[model samples]
Target: MEKLINEIDSIVMETQQITKQFQKGDEVEVTSHKLGFVGSYYEATIVSIEDANHYRVKYKTLLTDDQSAPLEELVPIGHVRPVSSHQLGTTSENRFRQYDKVDVFSSDGWWFGFISGIIEENYYVHFPTTGQEVAYPSHALRFHQEWSNDDWEA
Candidate 1:
């Protein structure tokens, strides 16, 4: 697993050197599973490229009937792959070793649950890595990392 992840990291770095076309006002198509934008792709902004190979996109979902209301608010979709430049984002932070617990967050800011057993078809979870078990579609999850028990204010 370590070797595979290292290989993936190298591929990411190589693609970083290539120039890609991304704009500020462009109607970006981000992949997720929400509503009109769920699974359907989202109209977002190409905020700015944080680095040579990375892009920063902001996604927002409006209420179905209420124009002024937002079914979901804006946060971060996250870093994407360089080869598939148009993808939204999903993060596999530092990574969780066996027995580590995690809290899964949906794009609209909802916590699905804590880490559970792994299955083939994403039963309780969706995309299951070695330690990270996926519960919802990539878009459904907006935030997930090791569940921190430390006090941030400390």
Candidate 2:
């Protein structure tokens, strides 16, 4: 596992180039950078472009302290991604491979990661956002895809 984690780290470093831009009203998924909320992503809409590196977004699921309104804040551009359109169904057979982009079911939500290693029936997933690795069964993993123009594409 240690060796696999090291390889995953290297793979993560090689894939750090993200150049995504969004216009106001575009729906997206934003990874939480907060202390306790790390590793989870919530649905949000880009309310406005704050600047070159940030977006003022209104979360669909996250709420403010008083619970009266949706939480709105400036999220770093790197932490936001377009909404995923294709979600694979869970199955018993191992259908994923190392370095494959996938979403792992954990913490009551699907957290994005890559398949770092496969051991028998379990898969080691590496999450770039939190720099964490976890082993999950095949049923807990799914292919990650992006939504584009009313269609799902890889």
Q: Which numbered prediction scores highest in TM-score against the true structure?
A: 2
User: Which candidate has the top score in lDDT?
Assistant: 2
> lDDT per residue, candidate 1, 1-154, as tens digits?
5654453333222212222355555444344334322222343566675665455665555354556643433323332211122222344653323222223344442332333443442324422222334544444323222111221110
- Candidate 2 lDDT tens digits, 1-154: 6665565444333322346568999998777646656556678899999998889999887789998999899988777777766455444563788888787767645676888898987889888768788999877777865443444544
lDDT of each: 0.36, 0.72
Query: How does residue 82 of candidate 1 score in lDDT?
Result: 19
RMSD of 2: 5.4
RMSD each, Å: 13.3, 5.4
Q: For each predicted model, how many residue pairs clash, with residues at least 3 apart or on different chains?
A: 7, 0
What's the TM-score of each model vs. the native? 0.29, 0.59
lDDT of 1 at 120: 40
**Residue 119, candidate 1: C-alpha displacement in angstroms:** 3.7
